[model samples]
Target chain A: MNQTAMAENKAITISFPEELSEVQEMVRACIQCGTCSGSCPNEFAMDFTPRRLWRMVLMGQKDDIFKSKTFSLCSSCYYCTLRCPRGLPLTEAMAALKQIAAKDGLSKYKQSSLFYKSFLESVRRHGKVREMEFMTMYFTAMKSPFLPFRFAALGMRLMGKGKVHIQIPSKGEGKLKAIFRKVEEMEGR
Target chain B: MNYLYYPGCSLEGSALEYNLSTIAFMEAMGIELTEIEDWTCCGASAAESVSHLLSLALPARNLALAETMELDADLMIPCSACYLNLRNVAEKIKKEPDILNEINTVLKEDNLELKGDIQVRHLLDVVATDLGADSLAPKIRKSLDGLSIAPYYGCQCLRPYTVFDDPEKPTTMEPLINVTGARVHAWDMGGKCCGASHMNTKMDVGMELVAAILRAARGADAVVTVCPMCQMNLEAYQKKISATYGEDLSMTILYLPQLIGLAIGLSDKDLRLDLNLSITESFRNKLNNDCVK
Candidate 1:
C-alpha cells in the first residue's frame, strides 16, 4: 500500500475517546438517514450537518469533528433525538460531544464553554442564577469589552420591566456549595 | 390538589411573570403549591454540556430537596428546560440504579440522597392532565372570545419524554385555549425550536429561528409560551429580528398561565402582564375591551 492509502486507512480506523463511548455506541446505529440533520433547527448554521457529523463519528475523524461547531450549535431541542429513526439519542450524543470538548478544554469552544461555566458558577454560588450577575460574570470572563454593550439595550429593557434584579455581590447562602465541591472532587477537576 | 413547586432561576428573574401568573392561576384553580426550600438551579441546558454528572446532580439535588418535603406529590416545574433537566435525572435514576447511586454519593455532600420516588412533571402536564380543560372551564370569569393565540410549546415540554402530550402533534394546549374561549391559531411552529440559549451564544442562528417562529405567528394576536427561554427569545428580540428579516414580526408573547389568568379574571398585576416585553398596544386594547370584566 502507498503512503496516502495507508494514511487514509489510519484515518478510517482512528479511535474516539472513552468519554464518548456512549455517543459512539449510539451513533453506530445511525443509518445516515439525515433525519437528525433534517430535524435540526440550527442545521443551516452548523459547520457540518448533524448527519455529516455522525458519518464522521463513525469514521473516527475526531479532529475534524471537534473542528466543526456542529455539537456546540445544538440547542438541545431534542427534535433530532425524537425524529431519529433508530432512536439513537442524538441530542444526548451531541451533549456528550460537548462534554468531551468541555473536558478537553478545547480553545475552539472557549466562548460557549465559558458561557456554560459562568452560568454554572453563578448557580453554584447563589443556588440560582442572578441574571445580571451571571451576565456580568460571563462578559467579564470573556474579556470582550464590546460584549456587554451588545446586550445593553436588552438589559435596559429587562431592567425597565423589573426583570433584571441588581444584587451587590456578597457571600451566597452556599446552598449548593457542598454538592458542587463534591462533584468537582469526584470529577477530578 | 397540591404540588412541590420548583421555580427555576429564570422564573425568579427574567420570567417572574411566569412565576406570578402560575401562582395566581394555580391558586385560583384550587391547587396549592409548596415551594421546595433552597431549590437551586436545575442546570438548564448548560450544565450537561460541561459535566453530565453535574447536570444530573444539580437537578437531583433539587429532587432530593423535594423528597425531603415529604409531600407525596409530584414536583411541578414551570420552566421547560428545568423540567427536562429534572425529569431527565428522575428518568435516568429510575432506569439505572448505579447512576442513582453515583448521584446519591454526590448528593451526600448536601446531606441528601436520590430515592427516585417523586415524579417530576411540567406545569403544562399538571394543567392538561391533572386539571383538565373541563375542570378549568367553570373558573373562567372573562372570555377571551375573539383573540387568536398561537400555542407555542417550544421544544422541551413535549419532546424526548412524551409524558403527557404527543411530541410531534401536541393538541393539549388547544383544548385549554378553547376553554378560555380563544381561537387556537393554525400554525405548525408549536413544537419548533426557538434557538434557545443560542440567542446568547450564536446570535445569527437564534435570530433566524426566532424570526421564523414570529413570522409564522403573524395571524395570531399573541404567542402563548410555556418556557422562559422561549418566551424571552420570542418576546425580547422582535424588533431586531424584524429589522434583520425586513418584516414586521411583532407579536405579544406571554406565558400560558398569564393567558389563563386573564380568562379567570385575575388582575394584570396578579399575572404580571406588564412585565411581558412584546405585548402590543392592540393586544392590550383587545384584552381590555373584551377580556376585562
Candidate 2:
C-alpha cells in the first residue's frame, strides 16, 4: 500500500484515548500465549476471552473492546496474572477497563456499575456497608421490580439466620465524609 | 504478640460468625487483637471499579489510623477482600512514593497521614506461620481425627500477591488442619476462584464456579475457609446449585478459625456454628462425641 493509503487505513481503525495509556502499556508485553484465557474461570461466559481482549487492546480497537462484556465478566481471580509468563498485571488491567467504562457512562455496563455505585454510597453514608440498605438502594436504582424477587428467598434465609439486620436508615456517623470528599476533589469528579 | 485489627464492614454484618470465631480462637491461643477505633471501610473490590483513587484513599485512611496507635505491630485483617485492598495500597505506596504522597493529601482531609510503614497480615498467615503445627498440636483438646476436611483457600488470600502461600497450590492450611488431628482431603480446588462479587453481578457465572468447587469437595466432611466471601458462596448457594446441576451438592462450610476453635475445646456457642448455613449431622455428632467435655 502507498503511504497515503497506509495513513488512511490507520485512521479508519479506532484508537484508544490517552486515558487508556496505562492499560495499553501493560498489555503491550502480551505474547499472545492464551495463558490468560486458559486460566480465567469465567472465560466461557465472556463474549471475548481475555487473550482476544488483550489483542484488541493492543490494536487500539476501542469500540470493539467496549462492545464486549469481557472485562465486566472478570471475577478478579488473578489466576491469569499469576500464570502469565510475561508477568503483566492482567487483573489490574481488567479493573482499569471497568473503571474507564464506568467513567465514560457506557449503557451496557449500567447494572454492574450501578451495583458498585450503590455499594460505595452505602460506605460513604455509614462508613460501613449496611447490606440491607445497600441492596435496597441498588434494587431501587435498577428500577427492576422483579430483581428483588430473584433474591428474596436468599434474603429471607439470611434474615432468618439473623444475618441481615434491619435498622432505620439514619444519617451515618459520617466518619468517611472527609475522605470521600477529599477523594472526589482530588479526582475532580 | 499483640496486633492491630481491622474488621472490615462484612465482619460486623453478614460474617459476624467469622468475627466471633476469630476472636474466640485468638483469645484461646493467647494472642492479643486491638480493634482500630473509628476505622472506615476498605472499599473492598467496589471502590476500584468506581474510582482507583478512592480505593487507595479508603484503605490508607485505616492504615493512618493504625499508625496513630503507635502499636509497633502488624495490622491484621480477617476478610480476604479487605486484606487485598489494604495490602494493595500498602505495597503500592511502598513502591511509588508519589502514590503515597497523593493518598496522604486525601488523608489530610481526615487529619490523618499514612507512613506506609505498617505491615498488613492476614489471619491465615498469623495462624499458619506465626502459630505453627508444633504450637497448635498440644492445644488440640478435641481431636478432629477421622473427619476429612478440605482446606479451601479461595482466591484473594493467595493471588495477585503471593506473600505467605503459593498462589496456585497452597499447603499452608493443610498443615494447620492436620495439626487439629484431621486428615486433609486431597483436592485441587483449594486455590480456585469462588467468583467473588460476580455472584452478585452475574449469578449464572458465579453459580457455575461455586458448583464446581462444591462438586470437587465431595468425600470431605466439610470445607474450611478463611475468607468470608468464600464461606458465604460455598454454603449459601448449595440448594440453588444443586437444583441447577441436578445433583446433591450440599456441603458443610465453616470458617477456618471456627474449625480450629472446635478442636481447641471452644464450645459451639463460642464458634457460632449455628450461624453457619450448612452443618451435617454426622459432623456435629463427631464433634459432640469427641470434643464436647
Candidate 3:
C-alpha cells in the first residue's frame, strides 16, 4: 500500500540466497494474499504463516524461513496449493523447503524427519516395508524406545487383527537395489 | 477387466484389511487384478519429504516395471497414496519428459524405463466409475439400508489433480454408496485432510485433525475411506484422539470396499472386516451381514 516505499524498492531486484532461488518465482507471483495461510489446516500451528513466509522468502530471509516451521509443518495435503490463486506449486515449494532444511542439517520437526529417514531406509533396503520391521527400525533409528510403547495399544490391536505382518519381501530385489543405487549415486548421498 | 494391481506397502502390513476387502470385492465383481511383480514402496508419506527425486524415482521404478511387463490395462492401485504417487509420476513423465529421462538413466542399467503409459487409477475410482453404479446395483445382495455413511475423501486422491472427483467437494463415493442402498451423509468434512503420516511425526496435531473429522461424522453410522492412512488414523487412532479431546467421539470406520463387500453378501472373513479396529456395534450387528448368519 506504500507507493513511496514500493517505488524506492522497485529499482533494486532482491536476490534470494542460492538455495532459495527456486522459490523466487513462487514468491514473485504471490500477491501477498493470505489465502495460503487461511487455507492451510496447520496454519494455527505454524509459527510464521505461509503468507508471511512467502514475503520473507522475497526479502531473502533464509535464516528466518528455515527456522520457522511454516514449510516443515506442511504435510503436502495440497490445500494451500489447491487454494492459491496464482496457481503456484505451493506443495512442491514446501517439499523444496524440506529438502533445503535437510541439506542445511536443520530439522524443525525432528520426529517427522526421523520418521521420513526410517521409512525411506526401510524401502531402500527391502524394496517393501514390513510394518513390524519399519516400526522397530524407526524406534531404533530415533533412539527412543518409549515412542513405540506409546502406540503399543494400537500396535497390539493391529497385531491382534492379523494386520501386523512378517514376510520375506520377494520380487526383483536385484532391480530394486539397483534403483536405490542409482538414486543414491545420482544424489551423491 | 484384467488390470495390474499395485497393493503398496500398507496393504501388506498395517492396512491388510484394505487389501483383503479390495481383493474380495474385486474378485466378486469379476475384476481380475494381477499384482505388479516385485513392487516396492511408492515412498508413500515419507519419500517425498526426504528427497523429491527419490520420491519420484521409487514410484517410477514400479511404473517402469509395470510398463516393462507390457501390462496394457490401466494399473489399479488400492491405496490412495500409491495411486497418487504412480499417477503423479506417470503424468510427470508425460508432461515433463526430462524427469522420466532423469529416472531412466538410473533405470537403464537394469533394463528398465518408465514409459508412463499406464493409466493409474484408485480402487475407489475403478469401482465407483469404471464398474459403475447401475451395474453394481444388481450385485448387492444385502442392501445397506438405514445406515448413514460418511465417505471420507482424505487428502491425497483428490488434490493437486482432481483425478476422479472434485478436489474440495467430492461425491464419487456417493453413487457407489447409494447403489449399495446406504444413505450418504452429505457433510462438509469429506474432503478434509487426515493429517496423513503426521500421526507419527506430529501426533498431537494429527490427532486433533482426525478428531475433528470423526466429530463431523458424528451423525453417520460409519466413516468409510478409500485410503489406508485415512482409515488407520480415523479407526486405529480414534480412541486416542477421543481421549485427547476428552470427548466420547467413538465411531466405526471401514474401507469403501468393506461396505460394498458386506452388501454383496460377502461374509466377514471374505472382507476381513474383523481386522478393522473400529467396528461399531451398530455396523457389526446391522450391516456386517455376520449378524444374519
Candidate 4:
C-alpha cells in the first residue's frame, strides 16, 4: 500500500541504460569465430545465437537486435563469454540489451520488473524475504494462480515451527522509514 | 579473513535452509560470518529493474550500515541477486560520481555512505577462493562418491559484470564441488536462467525456461545452486514444469551450503530436507543407500 508500489503499478515509460561504451568494447571483441554459437546451450532454441547478436550489434542493427526474440531467450548465463575466443562479455551485453529493451518497453519484461520490485519492497519492509505468504497472495491476486505452492507451504511450516519469523522486525522502528520514503519519491509514488 | 555476511532476503525465507546450513557449515570450515547489525534489504530483483537510482540506493543503504558497523572485513553476500545489487552499486558509484553523490545524499539522512572498501563476495566465491580447494579437500568428513551434482550459477552471481570467475562457462563452483568429493556434471545449463521471478508472473514462459534447464540437467542426481531464487524457481516449479514438458527430470535442487553440509556428514534432517520438492522417499533412499556415505 506504500506509494512506491503504487508508482510501479502505474503505466509509465521507463528509461533504459545509455548506450554503454563498455558494451561497445565488448561487441568489438567478438571475432566472429562462431565459437559462441557452438558453446551456446540454448542456441538451437533461440532465433539468434550469441555470435549473431554480436554481429548484429557490430552492423548497427541495434533496433533489430533489441526487438528480436533472441534477447528474451537469453538466460544471462556466461556460456558465450566463457566460450568467446575473443573473450567478449556476452552476458553483460545481453543484460545491457535487456535493460535497454525494458526501458524502451520493446519487450514484455514488465512482469520481470514487477517481480523484482515486489521482492525489494518485501525486503525493505521485512529486512528479509519472510513474506512468501504475502508474495504468493499478491502474485495470485495478480492472476498467476498456478504459482509454486511448495515454497508457500514450506514458509508456513517454517513460521509455525519457529524456524521463520513471520513478523516484520522493523515494525515501529522508523529506521527504514527514511529509506522507504526516499525510494517512494524516487519511484515517483 | 573475517567478513560481514549478507544472506539477503531469501536466506531468511524460502531458502532458510541455506542460511541455517551455511552458518553451520561455515563454522565447520573455520570461517566467521558476522551478520551486519540492523541490516536492510539489498532490493533483490525488482528495485534495480524499475529505477537505477532506486537499485543503487537500496544496496547503498545496506553498505552504509556495514560501514557504520565498522566491520573490518569485506561483505559476503550469499544470494545472487543481493550480491549483484550490492556489487553493482559499488561498481556504479565508482564510475558515476553523480550516482555516488545521489545515493550518498539519500544515505545522509541516516548519516551513511557506501565506503567502497567493503568487497562483496558470493558464498561460492568464499568457499572456492577464500577457503581454497586444497584446504577444503582435507576436511571432507564424508566423500560423495556416486552423487552427481550439476553446478547451476543462475545468472546474477557471475554475469552482467565479470567480477567473479568466467561469466560464460563459469566453473568457480567446480572446485568447491570437487572439494566436497562430488562429481560435477558437465552441462551447458549450469548458468542458465531458472526463470527467476518470472516464474511467478508468467508461468507458461517461466515453466518452459525451467523445463529447458531441467532437461539439460537430466543425468545429474541433483542441481546445486548459489542463488535462493534459482533454487526456489527450479525446485518449486519442477512438478509443474515436468508435467508441462512431459518429461520426468526428477532433479533435487539445493543451495551450495546444503550440499556442503551433506558432504561434511550432516544428516538430511540437519540440512532441512523437508523443504525440498525432489527429496522424495526414492531420493532419500538413494542418498542413504547409494552415495554420500
Candidate 5:
C-alpha cells in the first residue's frame, strides 16, 4: 500500500474526497448557527458537537471527525435538520458520517449495529424474521461466549413476559434463498 | 394503479402479519402490487451503517431488478427501512455515477440495472393518496369509536427528503386515523427516534428511549407505526423497560395497514392481532364486529 492509503488507514479519522462536492455543498449549507447543537438532546454528551462536525467536514479533517464518538451518538431523530436555520441536512450528514466511521471499523456503538446485521442476514437467509425461537438462537450464537447467559436471560424473560411470539415461516424456503441471493449480491457477500 | 413491490426482509419475517395485512389491504383498495421478480435485502440500518457499498449495492440491485422488469409503474415499498434504503440509493446514484456503474457491473451477472425510473413510495402514501380520504372514509364500515391511537411516523420514511411530508412533525397517518373515526393522540414524539437499533446494542439506552416515547404517548389507546424496526423496538422492549423502571404502560403497537384494515372492516384474525405484544384482546373488542365481519 502507498504512503497516503496506509496513512489514511491508520489515521484513526477519515474524511471523504474533495470530489465529493455534495459534502462540500452540505457543509456550506450549514451556517454553523448552532441550531442543531441547541436542538440536539445529546449534544452535551458529545465531545465535538454537531456544529464542529460540520466544520471538520468542510475543513477536510475527515480522519479526526470520523474517530469521534459524537457521530455515533446522533440518534438521527432529525431535530437538528428540522431546526437548522439554513435547512441543511444536518441529521443526514451525521448519518453519512456514521456510515463513514463504520467503514473504517471504528463504531464506538456497535451492539445495535451488530444485532441489525445478524437479524437482517437471518431474515435474508430465512425469508422472515422468525420470532423468539430462531431470533434467540441466532443472537446467542452471534454474541456467544462473551455474554452467553445474557442471551439466555433475555430469552427466558421475553418468554415469561409473553413478548416472544412463536412465529412460523409464512413463506416457503425457496423464496428465502432467492431473497438471500439478491441481498448477498447487494452486500457483495 | 400497479406497482413494482419490494417487501424487503421484514415483511417476509418478523413483521409477517404486517406483510400479510398490507397485501390484503392494498388488494382491497384496488392497488396492484407486482412483486419484483427476485428482490433482495435493502441492508436496512445495519449493512449500510457498517458498509456503505453494501447498503447502496443492496438497494441498487433491487432498483436494477425493477428496471429490468421494464415496469413503468412506481415501486411501492411497504417496509419503512426498505423504502428509505431504496430512496437513499436512488439519491446517491444521481450524485455518484461511478458507484452506480460499479453496482450495474455487479447486476450484469444477474441481468439487472439500478435505473432511477421506479418511484419508491411507502404503503402509507398509496393508501392515503391512491385511495383518497373520501374513498377510504366511506369504506370504513367499522368506525374505531373510542379508540385513541398515537400515530408514530418513526424516523425512516419521513426524514432525509420532503418526498412525503415534514420529517420533524409528520401527520401523514393522522388523516387516515381521523377518517377511521379513531382519535389521534396529540404527542410530541410522533417523529422522534425510539432508540431504534440501540435497543439491541445498549439495552438500557434502548429501553430508556422506548420509555420516553411510551411515556410521551401516555393516555393513548395504542401506538401505530410504519417502520418494522420502530414497531419491533417499541413493542418488544416495552416489557423490559416497565420491569426496569417499575412503571406499567403497555401500549399495543400496530402497523398503519393493520389499523387501517381494522377500520376498513377487516377482522382481527385477518389483521393478525395475535402477533402484537399489547392487549390485542381489548383492541380486538374495540373493532366493530358488525362492520368488519
Candidate 6:
C-alpha cells in the first residue's frame, strides 16, 4: 500500500476523485431507508446492499465503494431509483459508480464486464447486436466451451422463428464511428 | 398521424417480433411510422457503465441525425430502453448545458448537433393517448373474448422519467387491452424490474427474478409486456428458470403490440406470433380464428 494513501485514510477528511465530490454531497440525504436495497430485484446476491453502499459513501469509504460489486450488478432496472422515498436518483448514482468502477478497473463482476465488452464489440462492428454472434463471442471469450452448445437448441429455435438472427447485419451508419471515437477520446478509455 | 420510429438495435435483431407487431398495430390504426434513417444502437445498459459520455452521445447522435433530417413527426420508440435513451435527451441537454456543449463540441467534427427541442414519444404513449380508446374501438376486427392476460409494464418504460401514464400502478394499457375483450388481470408486480441486463451478466439471479414474475402470473394466458428485454427474459429463460425454481414455469411472454395487433385482426404473418418463445396454444388458436362478429 502507498504510504501517503494509507496515511490519508487515517485522516478525518480524505480526498475523493473529482467526480465523486458531487455524489458525496448528494448522498447526504440518504436516511438509510433500505427501500432501494429492498426494492432491488437482484439484491439477494449482492455482497453489499445499496443502502450499505450509500452508508459507505457517507463514510467516505471511497476504495471500498469503488471495489464493491453493488453497482456493477445493478442491471439498470431503475426500480430502486423510481421507488426511492428520498427521490435520490439512485440509479443515476449507480451508473456513475459503474463508470468509476470501469475507469478504476475495480469491477468485481467479471461476467458482467465481459458481457458489456461483448455488447460493445458488436455495436462497434455493425452498430447492431447480432445475438447469435454476440453469444458465440461471449461464451468463446469467457472460455466456456459448453455454454454455447447449451444455448444452441434455444438459439436454433429462435433462429427458426426469426427471433435470434444468424446473419450479421449493419445499420451502415458511418457517423456512428465519429460519435464513438469522440466519446472514446473524451472519456480517455 | 405520422411519427419517426426508432426501433433500436434489439428490435432489428433479437426482438424482431416486437418490430413486426408494432408495425402491424401502427399500420392497422392507419398511423404512418417512418423509421429514422441510419439509426444506430442506443448503447443501452452497456454504455452507461463503460462511459457516461458514450451513453449520452450514442443516443444523442441518433437525435442529432433526426434533427439534421428535419423529420416531420415526433420520434416514437417501441423499445423501452430506446425510449428512455431517446426521451431523456432533451432533459439531459437542458439540465446540463456544459455537458451538452462538451458533447456538441465533439459532435461538431461530424457536422452534426444534438438539439434539445426534439419531441421523443414511446409507442405505448401514442397508442393510449394519441390514438385514444374511441378511435381504436371501431378498429377491432377480432375480439380477444375469454382470453385472460396480464399486462407486464417492466422497467424503463415508465420510470427514471415517466413521459406517459402514472409512474406507479399504470392502468394506461388496461383500456387498450379491454377494447380487445381480453381480460386485463390486475397484478401488483406490473411495474417491477425484469432482472434486465442481469440475464447476460448474472444468469441464475435473472432466472430467479423471472420465476417470481411467472409465479405471480401463474394462471394468466400470457404476460403482455412492452419492453423487449423483459419479454426475452420472461420467455427465453423459462426452462432454466423452471429447473432452478423446481416448478414448471411455462409462461407465455407477449409484446403489448402483439396483443393489440391480434385483437385488431392482424394475421400471424403480420404480427409474427411464431417468433414468441413460450407460445400459448389457446392464444394462437384465437389469433388464427376469424374475428367473431
Q: Pick the candidate with the highest DockQ.
A: 1
Considering only N, C-alpha and C atoms within 3 Å, which residue pairs clash in candidate 4? A78-B167, A78-B168, A79-B168, A116-B45, A116-B46, A117-B46
In model 6, how well does chain A match by TM-score?
A: 0.76
TM-score of each: 0.95, 0.95, 0.92, 0.77, 0.80, 0.91
lDDT of 6 by residue, B65-176 (tens): 8887676788899889888987776678888789789878777766778777778888888888998778879988878887778888887888888778777778888898
Deviating ranges (above 4 Å) for candidate 5: A1-30, A41-48, A55-67, A86-89, A107-189, B94-99, B288-293
The clash numbers for all candidates, in the given order, read: 0, 0, 0, 6, 10, 0
Which ranges of candidate 2 are over 4 A from the true structure? A1-16, A167-173, B290-293
For model 6, residues A52-115, the per-residue Cα lDDT tens digits are 9999987878767765678777877777888888888788888877766566544364566677
Worst 10 residues of 2 chain A by lDDT: A7-16
lDDT of each: 0.88, 0.88, 0.81, 0.70, 0.71, 0.78
Candidate 1 stretches with Cα past 4 Å from truth are A1-16, A168-173, B290-293
Q: Residues B48-136, candidate 4, lDDT per residue (tens digit)? A: 44455666787888888887777689888888888988988888878878888788777876778776668888888888888877887
The docking category that best describes candidate 4 is acceptable
Candidate 4 at residue A57, lDDT?
76
B181 in model 6: Cα distance from truth in Å? 0.8
Worst lDDT 10-window in candidate 1 chain A? A7-16
**Candidate 4: stretches off by over 4 Å:** A1-117, A127-130, A133-175, A183-189, B290-292
Off by over 4 Å in 3: A1-17, A165-175, B288-293
Error of 4 at A158 (Å): 7.2
